[model samples]
Target: MTQTPPTVAEAIRDAALRLAETSDTARLDAEVLMAHARGVTRSELLLRHMRDPAPKGFAALVARRAASEPVAYITGTQEFFGLPFAVGPGVLIPRGDSETLVEAALAAAPQARRVLDCGTGSGALLLAVLANRPQAQGLGIDRSPAALAMAAANARALGLDARAAMRLADWHAPGWSAGLGRFDLVLANPPYVEDAAELAPSVRAYEPAGALFSGPEGLDDYRVLVPQIAGLLEPGGTALVEIGHRQAGAVCAIGAAAGLSCVVHRDLGGRDRVVAFSVTNELAA
Candidate 1:
C-alpha cells in the first residue's frame, strides 16, 4: 500500500521547525530535505507540492536532519562555486568559504596551463577551476586513497576527467614532486584549524580528523609541504592556500622563509581565509 505525502507547505514547515532545534541551517535544510523527499529540485518543489504520501524512508531522512547531521552529508552532495560535488562521510564537504581560495587561485593565474591541487578532498577546488578554464590541465593529489577516489569520481561527474586526474600522494613526503613537471599554479586548502578543541561540534565529531587537523599548531602540513613543493612551482607560478582565520601571520612567515612572498586574502565575512604566494627565487633539483 502506498502512503500519502504531507502537503508541501506542511513538510517544509515541519522540517524547518524540527531542524531549528539543533541546526543553525534550519530553513535551508528544510527546503533541501523536502525537495529530496518529493524527488524534485528545490525550485521545482516550490512550484509544486508533493501530490503523494511521504514514504517512511523520507521521514527517516527528516529524522536524520533533526539529529544534527549536516544537510550536505545527508544529501550526499553539495554545490561549490556553482557546480555539484559528491560528498560523504570520509571526505570533507565542499564549503562556500573555501571557494574564496579558488577565487584567489583563478585570479592569480587566469590563463595557467598546468595546475596542481594538493589534498584535493572532494576535488572541489580542482573541479571548480577546470570548469572555468576548459583548456587547463590539473592534477589533484591526496594522501588518503578514499579521498582520491572521491575526487576522481567528482572529476568524471564534472566532465573534467579528460583534463584533470587524481592521485594518492602525501605532499610532505620525500621526492614527491619528482615525476610531475613544474606547475604554473598550486591550489590547496590543507587542514588549518589551530584549535581543534574549538571546532563546532559537528566538525570535531563528524568530519574526518585527518581532513581537519594538522598537528597541535595546525602549521605542520605547511611547514613540511611548502618548502618541498616550492621546487615544483615554475618561476612566476603562484600558489593559493587557504589558512586558518587566526593563522595568517604564521602562514605568511612560513611562506617567506620558504622563499616565497605571501599575501593574505579575505572571505566575504572579512576574515582572512586564503594566502597567496609566489616563488621568489629559482630552484634546482
Candidate 2:
C-alpha cells in the first residue's frame, strides 16, 4: 500500500528541525521556504498547515536551505527599508544593518536632490533613499555588470527608473567617479569583512566573496573610498558609509585625514554601523 504524503505542517516541522542544526532562525526559514514552494505567503501557509500536503519540490528547497544557502537568495527577494529587492548569487543580499545607512542619509539630507551610491548591489541604499525622498535623483555605481543589471532592474520594477541611473565602475579604481558630478548625498556599503575573520556558512559559502571580504584588516575598501568621498560631495553634502562593527575609530581617522569631519552612528544593536562625514564641521541632527 502507498503511504500518505506528509502535511504542510509536518514538512515544515521536519525542515525546521533539520535547519535548526545549522541556522539560528530555523523555523522562520522553514516557513518562508515552505510558503515559497507553495506559491503562497507565510500566513497562507499557516492557515493551510494541517490541511494541505507539502508541494512537489518543496523538499529540494528545504535541502538547499539545509545546505546553508541564504533564504533571500533562495527566494530571490530581500526586504530593505520596507521595500522588496531582487537578490541572487552575484549580488550581496541587503541586510537590516545596512538600513542604518539609509536612515542616516534621509535624516541628514532630506532635500538631497542628487545622490550617489557606491557598490550599489541590488541598489538597496540608493533606491531606498529615492523612494522616500521623491524629489531626488540618484546614480548607482558598481564593478560587476551582473550586479548593475540587477540594480537597474530593481529601479524599473519600483518605478524609479526615470530617476535612477546605474553604471559599471569600480570604487577602488582611481577616477572612477569622474564625470559623475558632485552629489548632495553619497552612500556606500562596501566590502569590510576582514580576510581572516570567520563568517557564517551561509555568508562565506554562498555570498560573493568580493562583496564581503576586504584586505587583511577589512579596512582596505575604506582606505580607497573615504578620501574620494569629499570630492564627490557638494558643499555641505554628507557621505554615510557602512563600516564593520570594529571599524569606527579607523574609518573616522581616515575621514579626518581627508579633512572631512566624521561622526559615527550605531545600529539598533548599539554596534557601530555607519560613519557619516561632511566637509562642514556640523552634520545634520
Candidate 3:
C-alpha cells in the first residue's frame, strides 16, 4: 500500500525542526517557504495547514533552507518599507537595518524632487523613497549590470519605472558622477564590511561579496563616496548613507573633510546605521 503524504502542518513542523539547527527563525522560515510553495500567503497557509498536503517542491525548499540559505533568497523576494522587492544571487537582499537610510532620506529632504542612490543594490532605497514621494524622480547607479538589471526590474514591478532610472557607474572610477546632474538628495549603502570581519554563514556564503566587503578596513568606499557628496548635491541638498554600526565617527570625519555637516542616525536597535550629511547648513537654517 502507498503511504499518505504529510499534511501542511506536519511538513512545516518537520521543516522548522530541521531548519532550527541552522536558522534562528526556523518556524518563520518554514511558514514563509511553505506559503510560497503553495502559492498562497502565510495566513492562507495557516488556515489550510491541516487540510492540505505539502506541495511537490516544499521539501526541496526546506532542504535549501536547512543548508542556511536566506529565506528571502530562497523565496526570491524580500519586503522593505512596506514594499516587496525582487532579490536573487547577484543582488543584496534588502534588510530592515537599511530602512533607516530610507527614513532618514525622506525626513531630511521632504521636498526633494530629485534623488540619487549610488550603490543601488535592489533599488530598495531609491524606489522606496520615490514610492512615498510621488512627485520625486530618482536615479540608481551600480557597477554591476546584473544588479542594475535587478533594480530596473524592481522599478517596473513597483510601477516606478517612469520615475526611477538605473545606470552603470562605479563609485571608485574618476568622474563616475559626471553627467548625472545635481540632486536634492543622495543615498548610498556602499560596501562597508571589513575584509576579515566574521559574518553569519548565510550572509558570507550567499550574498554578493562586492556588495558587502569594502576593503581591509571596510571604510574604503565611504572614503571615496563621502567626499564626492558635495559635488553631487545641490546647494542645500542632503545625503543619507548606511554605515556599519561602528563607522559613525570615521564616516562623519570624512564628510566633514569635504565641508559637509554630518549627523548620525541610529536604527531601531540603537545602532548607528545611517550618516546624514548636507553640503550647507541652509537646510537647518
Cα-based TM-score, every candidate: 0.93, 0.96, 0.97
Model 2, 183-241: lDDT tens digits are 99999999999999998999999999999998999999999999888789898899999
Question: Which of the predicted structures, 1 or 2, would earn the higher TM-score when compared with the native?
Answer: 2
Q: Write the per-residue lDDT of candidate 3 for residues 201-222, one digit (tens) a residue.
A: 8999999999999899899999
Q: For each candidate, how many residue pairs have backbone atoms clashing (under 3 Å)?
A: 5, 0, 0
lDDT of 1 at 162: 98
Native RMSD of candidate 1 (Å): 2.4
Ten contiguous residues minimizing lDDT sum, candidate 1: 49-58
Where does model 1 exceed 4 Å of error?
A: 1-5, 50-55, 281-285
Candidates' lDDT values, in order?
0.84, 0.93, 0.92
The full ranking of all candidates by TM-score, starting with the best, is 3, 2, 1
Q: Report the CA-based lDDT of candidate 3 relative to the real structure.
A: 0.92
Candidate 1 C-alpha lDDT tens digits along 160-255:
999998888987777777798888889998887664458766677778888888888999888887775577788788888888888899888988
Candidate 3 colliding pairs = none
